[model samples]
Target: MRGSPPLPREFRLVPGRTFVDASVLVRLFDDDEPVRQAAARALVGDLNGPALVVSGPVLAEFAETVMVRLARPLAPVAVRRALTELSELTVVSADASLVLAAADTAEEEELGLRDALTLEAAVLGGCDRLATEAMRHGTVLRGIHVEDPAFGGNE
Candidate 1:
């Protein structure tokens, strides 16, 4: 799933880093859809802005999808390296608090557990923006701003 304009190394992200979802994450490496991949590249490689934030669960979900690609599964070492590379962003671990908050988010937002988990992770990470293709673009989740970077929205 590796590609040019690759996920950066040693990138530093502050608390306000925009949270990134797995939808964009997968595109950044997989080349599944060229249009989406370009969008992901544009968003991630926008050097003038802060690096997007990501979390443990987000990377895990991304990994699960990438490891079982229809063409060929990623090697374990590649998966491990990808996870490590993703951790360069501001990442909140999926711990007891996050899971509990996700439960609440699911109940309140009427979202599935995975979606709720993604949103809750953004909130807990102190992010003000969420970059994803999952939600209605530009809709705010409570106070967190949500947008689809794939559609040219800047996080």
Candidate 2:
């Protein structure tokens, strides 16, 4: 069996240094939700990471949910504004190779397609950590650490 890859170098929490996943993004904007508040606080306040990293697929998925389906659907102008602000983040694109990698990761980890894609994007973007509320503690993907900001930090 192949050995697990080495962990990426530890990154100091500086501005522009971490990748923000869809889960965190959803929470950041959903102020009504407690989890979202916690994540937003952790990210925008405490983490102090430089240039948040976001993937194209992640943005598209978030837009579909927050702009299309949510009861208080985001207006086009609002969505555009959000996207523009997010553009300040280091955006990673998912190409053919990354798609294939995501498929492979899904098969290996038994994760759903979206989760696999998220993992692939994080790895490609050279993220040391992926912040999300969806994953449990101690979950590792391609040597990148998965952290649930809501439950983490106290440990």
Candidate 3:
């Protein structure tokens, strides 16, 4: 992914770059939660690269959830197509720096490693917000605000 200079810290109050978590992505194809499905669709309807950020771990989680955890699992080809369609969004790769940062966040936030990785990915990707259903609304981790976009929270 191309690197963009981090925005000034004060820009946090504004809606800028957003990191999407797997929880929201999985809702896109989940027929069981129609309200959330609609909200998820609306949140991502117009988002594109640069403004939208996602990480490798998040994508993998999404793929796994859709394949094995969903009530109606998608075929491999369908999942492949979905992933391909997401190519427009910026994707962050997990690395040594990311792992170390996540480890620190895990201890500091009392979050699991996977959740910490998602938070750290948002910071490393220069995101001002993180949209997910996995964390409490309004929780801030390392300068990124985590919210559940499908509910009553920031997108």
Candidate 4:
């Protein structure tokens, strides 16, 4: 995910960074449902993260969702800006090791490939906690805590 600053094939958590999954990012900008929209907005607005952790897959996922899943697709420029905003965070590119571990984690956890990959990325990226709706709230996978910030919550 990083090039200019350069990142190792394996990522290391910067100091204090929480892994943010694409679901959270999508919710943050989505307004299809008023209650959920407000919850997402509040979650993000309340976070004053000194630093954040994200992966290449997470950014791509967010871009695709905002561009395709919304009631009206966002303009290319809008999508680009959103991606840029996310990319500005501490970014890590998932590597072969990460994928393999994710596969193991997925199999053990019975999670879909995407969910496992996101969780695996967070663990490998060294985030102590993951903000996502991909798994049960308070569930721990790969030693990383998972939490869904949605008020209405994952249904």
Which candidate's lDDT is highest? 3
lDDT of 3 by residue, 8-122 (tens): 5733433578889999999999999999999888878766566888899989999999999999999999999989877568888899778887887788889999999998888
List model 4 lDDT by residue over 83-139, tens digit each. 877777777688887777777777888999889889877866767778887778887
Backbone clash tally (model 1):
0
Which candidate achieves the best TM-score against the true structure? 3
How does each model score on TM-score? 0.80, 0.81, 0.87, 0.80
For all candidates in order, the CA lDDT equals 0.74, 0.71, 0.82, 0.74
lDDT of 3 at 92: 80
TM-score of 1: 0.80
Which ranges in model 3 have alpha carbons more than 4 Å from their true place?
1-15
Tell me the lDDT of model 1 at 77: 92
Per model, state how many residue pairs clash: 0, 9, 0, 0
Q: If candidate 4 were superposed on the true structure by all CA atoms, what would the RMSD be?
A: 5.6
Backbone clashes, candidate 2:
9
Model 2, 1-155: lDDT tens digits are: 22234434642233235667777777766756776567666775664434467899889877776787665677888888888877777787888777877888888888888888888778767777777766665677767778777765424
Q: How does candidate 3 score on lDDT? A: 0.82
